[model samples]
Target: MKQAIAQYNEAERLARQEKFREARPLLEAAAKSGYGRAWYALGNWSIHGIGCRKNYRQAFECLRKAVRYGAGREALFDLAICYETGKGTSKNVRQAARCYIESMQAGDPEAISEVARIHYWGIGVKPDHSKARRFYLRAARRGDLESAYLLAEMYLTGEGGTTNRRSAIDWLKRAVDSDDAKLAWDAKERLKQISAVTM
Candidate 1:
């Protein structure tokens, strides 16, 4: 057990230094010993072909094992993405939503944003603006700029309930300060339009 952990640790160290090739064998060793993180790492590597051939089947298997062994939030989130995009498995929107929900339950804030998206778009699940609003609010409060931007739109359009220009403006202002250039630009543009209309 200790040896497996050591292998996983060393693999992580090597991967951080961009030595994926060197880390692969160690990760494989740890994964074979039932290390969840190692399985997660191997899954990601298989998906992206970092140090091995890109094999969706292999990626799916590794990710499944990782999740079974209690992988971290990222692995769960990635698994959700896989289900959503058919990366290593058949595209299954319902399964994707389930994985996203699981990821959220696993404490992945990003999954909150994804859940909001699905609700807002009626993807695989019934469209529920109220649910989307709730998820967006949660993610935004957790400092997710994209969620804040989406929340601002919801406020502006009254997607879930009554329109609140003030709330929209506040969220836009917060988005404007984001480091993401595209989001900041959109926020600035929206703020301008809002000001023009109000003025």
Candidate 2:
């Protein structure tokens, strides 16, 4: 275990410095030696076309191995992304949603945002706008900027149920203040519309 941990740390150090060629072998070694994090990292490296040619098959295999070895939210989130995007397998929204839900249960903030997205968009299941609102609220309260923006949209459109102009503006303000530029821009647009309303 100690040796595996050392190799894993070394792999991380090498990868962080962008020494992809050297890091690959170290990560492989650590992953083969039963380091779950190494497997998960290696999976990401393969999936993102980083350091090596994009190989979804290899990424899926490595990520699955990671989950098998007790990888936490990171692995599940990546796996869900892959499923949703058809990276390794056929695009399977149901599978993606399941993985996102699992990751949320595991307390991954990104996963929470993703699950909220799935709910809001009705990606893999029947549209449940109320459920979407609940998820958005959860993520927004946790400071997920994307969710905050979604909450604003929902409020403007009355998507969850009743229209909430105040909540919409409040969430838009919060999203605009956050670091996510895409969501900030979206919030800005909504805020403009809301401000322009003659009441």
Candidate 3:
């Protein structure tokens, strides 16, 4: 195990230097030796053809192995995306949701937002605005810009409960600080609209 980790670390260093060809064999060796992160790295490389040919099937297999070996929360999220989009496996919304929930349990803020999205849109399960609001609030408090925006909209429209304009404005204010130009613009426009209405 220690040897595998060492090999994987060397591969990571090579990869950081853009030595993809030199890193590939090391990553493969580490993965074969039961290093979960190596499996995850190989999976990502396979999916995008970073150093290998694009092979969704191989990506799926590697990612599945990584997940079984407890790769990381990010790996779970990536697996969820693959399941949701049918990138390497069959489209299975239920499985995707399960993976997202698992990732969320692992404290991935993006996964938390995804769970909120699925609940809000009823992608694979029943639409539950209350649950969406709860998840969005959790993600928003963690500084997820998208979740903050969605939570603000929910508060403004009273989708899950009583309308709270103050809460909506607060969330929008938080969103205004986002680095994303579109989100910042949208938040600013909404804030202006709200202010006009109140005036």
Give candidates' CA RMSD values in order: 1.3, 1.8, 1.1
Query: Taking the tens digit of each residue's C-alpha lDDT, what string does model 1 give over 34-87?
Result: 889889989998999998899988898899999987795768888888888998
What is the lDDT for 29 in model 1?
A: 95
Clashing pairs in 3: none
How well is each residue in 169-195 modelled by candidate 2, as lDDT tens digits?
899899988776776787788788888
Local accuracy of candidate 3 as per-residue lDDT tens digits, 12-115: 99999999999999999989988889999999999899987999889988998898777967588888889999999999999988889999898777898999
User: Which portions of model 3 miss their true places by more than 4 Å?
Assistant: none
- Report the poorest 10 consecutive residues by lDDT, candidate 3: 67-76
Name model 2 segments beyond 4 Å from true. Answer: 178-182
Off by over 4 Å in 1: none
By TM-score, the candidates rank as: 3, 1, 2
For this target, which candidate reaches the highest TM-score against the unseen true structure? 3
Pairs of colliding residues, candidate 2: none
> Distance (Å) between predicted and true CA of 118, model 2?
1.3
